[model samples]
Target: MTPAFPDPHPTTSTIAEVAICEVGPRDGLQVEDQIIATEDKITFIERLANAGLDTVEATSFVSPKWVPQLADSAEVFAGVRHLKRVHLPVLVPNERGLDRALAAGVESIAVFVSATESFARNNLNTGWQEALAAAERVTSVAQTSGLHVRGYVSMCFGDPWEGRVPIDDVLSVARRLFAAGCSEVSLGDTIGVASAGHVRELLGRFTAEERTRLALHAHDTYGQALANVLAGLDSGIRIFDSAAGGLGGCPFAGSATGNLATEDLVWMLEGMGIRTGVELPSLVEASSWMADLLGRASPSSVVRALSA
Candidate 1:
């Protein structure tokens, strides 16, 4: 049954507003086999901003040899730096990546840390403890430069090789990020095995005040992203990370259906009287445009339904 879409004037509430961080350009395109053009990537980001997503992750400043898709991070940032209404943050993987972001006039940067040893070695090329230390270094240096820093803790729910992950392990990494001066810590369900109860249990360990500084970066690998998001909302989380058109997965992680779709997230949030400040029709259009450019239909249920 297709639920009735929200009215033109949806219900409003003071405490029900949510912020969607669109990650199509950065997290979405980074792992794709198809290398989207620099101009198209810029336009895609601009279209997302026009759709009313105030925060769009532009691109990562990783080495071109490592992530060729976003090799032109500086050019991409230059293209959309004029959008005053939107906040575009680039991912800085290390000190070199941070240097590139600083040169690109980036105002905000995100540093990633791994929660599992396997993922840490694969993604950040170090042990989990060392990866945490590296993240701290990047966070401290980025802070010194007066740039806002957001930290990501990946593999929080489960690991492919290690099976289930412990809550204590995830908590330690998250608290390390907070202590290292990160303004917000995004808990990533990298392989997306998180259930609603698991989401509640994980978040319940944090104080209500701590929840305020947290965001959920969910994946639909197990079709639980939306449910997990609802659970997070119930626990007082305000920020959510998603990609437009459901377009990305980690190249290091062996999962295909990763990244929750921005359209889907906006649809659920707006319909439930939680304002996401995005135009669903416009967002769907943007994702469809990118899907066409990529020569594949979007995997997003909302995008598929609306684009149908």
Candidate 2:
């Protein structure tokens, strides 16, 4: 049984499935003014996993002084044990952060890097080079411990301080992260300014093999996240990052807004006949519960429509 197209891009031909990494507990919660209680955060992750999200980023191991919203990272990790079916990856800022993650017995970890100098200074409190060095060091050490590492390159499309980010700048950081041992690198449209054209151009720079290792983290501020996701699918990208209920943005990047909603992404993927393995009804209910906890309506359009 030979097929017409040996390989089908997720966009045009039928691709089997898309990996949706739910970031509601980590990237989503990090920016909130309302501190979701630690138990609630644990419950949130459990609910997301139970609803069939394969991967859920649990929390970041950074100084609580800087991100007070996730001050209970260790406690949250401790209270909730990892599930056999879920891939729970925690963000570690550096070797020090990595130490905390190791002690918490995490199976996978993620390191984030800024694609611009201004964002490096503001978000990481260090120059881009220095912060990248730390990330590399952390990645190496984590790999040594037999843990999977995912690298995050933020502000890849545009930065609040630097305007449109040069693709070369993103390439420099992305290559370094891969060289340092990241199994996958997620490109972030941090300020939500990137459109389909820009996304295609940036992804075009990679070879087929490199493209296989890439993921898209498109925020929805300009309402182009799903369009960018389609572009990524056209480019053969399989992984996409989203937060439930469109929960959070980068606290350091003020122009940044809610990430692409998991519900929205799920609905779109399933509609496109790309299996996400997520039940929309249960996902919506979970997001609604979290929204109630946060004392607000969900920012996700799909959630709003479905709940209504």
TM-score of each: 0.96, 0.95
What is the TM-score (0 to 1) of candidate 1? 0.96
Per-residue error (Å), model 1, residue 207:
1.2
Q: Rate the local accuracy (lDDT) of all candidates.
A: 0.90, 0.90
Task: Show the colliding residue pairs in model 2.
Answer: none
- Model 1 clashing residue pairs (backbone): none
Cα lDDT tens digits for candidate 2, 67-110: 99989999998876757788889999989899999998998999
For model 2, the stretches where C-alpha displacement exceeds 4 angstroms are 1-13
lDDT of 1 by residue, 1-308 (tens): 22344464556654568888888899999988888999999999999999999999999999999899999999999999999999999999999999989998999999999889998888778899998898899999999999999999999999887878899999999999999999999999998889999999999999888899999999999899999998998888999999999989888888746599998898787777887889888888899899999898999999898766
